[model samples]
Target: MRQITAILVGAGARGRFVYGEYAKKYPKELKIVAVAEPNEERRQLAAKDHGLSSNQLYESWEQVLDGAVMADVAVISTQDRMHCAPTIKALELGYDVLLEKPMSPLSEEVNTMANASRKYNRLLTVCHVLRYTPFWSKIKEIIVSGGIGQIVSIQLSENVGYYHMAHSFVRGNWNKAEETSPMILQKSCHDMDILSWLIDQRCTKVSSYGSLLHFRPENAPVGSTLRCTGGCVVERECPYSAVRIYEEDDPCNEWNRFITNKLTPEGIREAIEHGPFGRCVYRCDNNVVDHQVVNMEFESGSTASFTMSGFSHDISRTVQIMGTLGEIRGYMEKSEIVLFPFGGEAIEVPVTVEEGGHGGGDEGLMREFLKQVRNENSNDDQGLTSAEASLQSHLMAFAAERSRLEGGKSVTIAEMMELQFTQVKGVASPNKVT
Candidate 1:
């Protein structure tokens, strides 16, 4: 296999650990020759792991672009606000781009990137990794094979685990919608994308309702302090206790490993003492909803209801599809799928879970990106999570947020797209996601 060169835009969690590890594991398939990260620690870590020289490291994405086009593709995993700029530049520089999810928090930027990819005739693959997972892939296969008949309704629930909500949404990088994207866009766009893809139709209308119900100042225990370690009498009693979650210094702890690179006791304590993750979950600056429900109607007359809640014990997604002749139910965490055909015996389908993040979706995504860049066979079983498909999902998310803010008023996809275009072209457009 001919190795392809890649440039890393961000060396943070998803960048350094997930995609960067792919290069480390399969050096012949991908060689990360350069990296651009503002964070010193992450930059250093990525440098050492990728065996990149100091000159190959840059402080910012702009700095990376200032240098010669160094890679065949640019793996842009920067945060939501930082996605569009680097990705647009990378495409302009004749590099295939693998962008992180939610493309951009702003709808205009999302449209701009989509148009830019087409304008340049470059492959712009969004990180809609779920499309690449065996679990979802199997579901897609069943639906396509007529095993489930015509998809009429889909019920998908993203049970964002209690620990995860408190750690990432409530305290970590994505606490506030203003700083990041809305909870639906940042946390649940995968659902929107999958719903559209599985049904293979445009979302015509969407209405949603949600709020920051449980995590707030008034919701905090009567005696809770601003920080978790601030001598709150109920520290041990709180399920979201920073003490309980970060007390251990074990590096192997799944949650611990993601929070800090330094897994020592002193490191953990230092983080808890001053870091954002150490803040009281109920007293933090988080403004995103703790629970939400979205209703979608597709052009094919199929419907989907998505519920995302932070109260669940496990971080997983469960989906049930109702069809004319059969129904399909899947649990991503279990990697299990059951087909219940009307008047027929239910069958369990086997799934092969590859080793990596997001239930092996990360590896699946990287493999597809590498294949596309290598000009490998195009006629295959791979689903195209291309720029247009990604844009459709993003519109769904943006419309859902709009409907939520408008008191659950149904928004049309046409209006949403028009609104998106108006803003993009200095005029108003209208549509909603259903």
Candidate 2:
């Protein structure tokens, strides 16, 4: 067996979880040899949690790659803006890369990263995990089987629950549009990627409109501070109380125990007060849209609508597809597919969940990624969305943001790509992180 040593950049929540799985589940196939993080505390926690020796820790990716060819692969799960540098560096250092999605905060960076992968002839896979889910695979199969013939339109809406959106974009790292683009790019790029893959078409133009209506600093109710549970008069009415929501053992909580326990209660208190989540739900520095609608036209003569809302009652995606002969409606979480023929009643099709993150795509993604890395035969037995396919969809969000800001003008995919190419061609790639 080829022993593949891996390095994890960003010792944050998702990075730690992926590293944990590598350590516990696929120890024989992949070994986490090192970690790079600028955050001293997070670095230490990751080292302690993953049992890394001092020699295996680095303050930055530059330090890790400095005369050290220790990792067979570099997992780039850093901030959106920081993705391109480390990933390109990893490839330059003769390591394959598994990049986390949205590719980068800016379209130019994404093109540069893609260019580096091609230039280096390295296996650079983005973590577009949706292509790995069992439910999505079934959906794709149904569509390919012509469960709805000659597809013409698709309506996909993401219900990014109030708490989830608040936790991630409101109080999290994705609050600012300049820093992250719209919530569309930051959160829905995955959906966009999957949608493009499902339709097998290039998005020609996109026009989007949305705004941060609810979670603004000015929208805080009477007598409410940043945090709802702390001293707000409406604490009883708000459901996002840090105490009530996070006190018990939940999936998100368990996911963070490795790091959360390291923070003292007072530390947590201070963070909540100062962090994005601690802000009033109706009042924050967040500029990303809480509710958005995007109209897209695909090159294949099909149309699509994408809606993302933060105030949804639940976390699920409801999709509708219209075709020449029939129509299909499905829910991602429920895993149900219903087809309505042009002249007949609806028929039910079954869909079920696998068992990990994002409707069980995490594990399925790992399976395919590992198989590919190990040179094992892998197939779309359970649908697998490739890097190029996923990248096309993710880029739509960036294009849509441009459209949204430019008075709802239609932005062409080709135009956006040309702009990115020009910008990246002018920028020199960073020196290998070493």
Candidate 3:
């Protein structure tokens, strides 16, 4: 295989995971030639960790792409809204791209990335890493193998788990709808994409209903203001206390503790006190819905309902598929599947668990992407999610958000493409449509 040089943009949480878990495991197929991050501390860390020279660490996407056009690929792990600029730039610069999901904040930007891939003859793949996960893959195989014959509908619910949701949305970048589009687009775009891929049908209509029912000052117990973990008398009783869990656990709390020494107790304290995670989970300025439900109609007459909630005990997903002949229910966290035949008894299927980021999907995706880019070829054997597939998933998310805002009106994929994203309509519009 040819050596594929890759430049990774962004050095945030997810970006670091991609580098450490995925790229670190596949040095032969991929090489980190450069990294672009505005934060000096992070850029230096990436350089030191990857053994790259100072010159290879750029301050922005433009600098990286300008100097590294010869780089075989670009891995975009930037902020949600910033995905379009680097992805479009990389494609135009003759580099294949592995873009992180949700493609971009707006449909038009996603469409632009699609156009650029075609126009530049660049191979662009979206980082819908869940598609590569073993459990999800098994579920897909079961459906494809007719375990649930003539699948009619699917119901998937994500346990967005209160503390996790509080950490991400209530205290993080996705606090408000306007701040980060809707919760659907920001978080569950992957879920929407997974459904589309599993059903093998076009999403024809989408209707949704949701609101910020919790995680507000109104929901806070009396006399308990911001910083529940810091000052609340009930910190020991509250499950969401950062002090009790994170501080007590020290190096054990998987979510709070950092692998590097830089993420010290002082850093955690400072972040929570002033940063997104530090605020009282119940007193933040969050506006995104704590719970949302989406009703979808497919072109092939199949239908599904998707629910996302910020309050749940589990962190994984559960799927129930109802079909003409039988039904399949997948418990993702436990890696167990139940198949209920229409007239016969139910059987349990066991699946293996692999240790790595994103249920072992991250490493697989990196391996496949590097293989394709190194060979400069595309094949079914690789099965990487293409730019088009990613856009379809993102568009479905857009439609779902529209449905939520407009009283659950059905939104067709065609309508979204034609009405919102077919043409250049935004300030950062790509005028030259490919």
Candidate 1: Cα lDDT at 383: 33
Largest lDDT belongs to which candidate? Answer: 1
Write model 2 residue lDDT over 1-434, tens digit each, in one string. 66667889887777877655655566777778899989887888778876798888999988887886786678888888788788888889887778888787666677677667667766777788877877778778878998678779999999998668767777677878677556787789888887887888788998988888887766677877666546888866676555444443444443124324446667555555554446666766677788888999998789999999998867889999898888888888887888798888988877666777788887777666666666732222212444455568766887778777777888888877777666667753211100
Off by over 4 Å in 1: 249-253, 376-383, 428-434
Q: Tens digits of per-residue lDDT for model 1 on 128-224? A: 9999899999999999999978999999999998988998899989988877889999999999999998999889999999998999888888788
Candidates ranked by lDDT: 1, 3, 2
Q: lDDT per model, in order?
A: 0.87, 0.74, 0.77
Question: Which residue pairs in candidate 2 have backbone atoms (N, alpha carbon, C) closer than 3 angstroms, thus clashing?
Answer: 62-433, 171-276, 171-277, 216-282, 216-283, 216-284, 217-283, 217-284
Query: What's the CA error at residue 1 for candidate 2, in Å?
Result: 6.4
- TM-score, each model? 0.95, 0.89, 0.91
The true-versus-predicted C-alpha distance at residue 144 of model 2, in Å, is 1.7
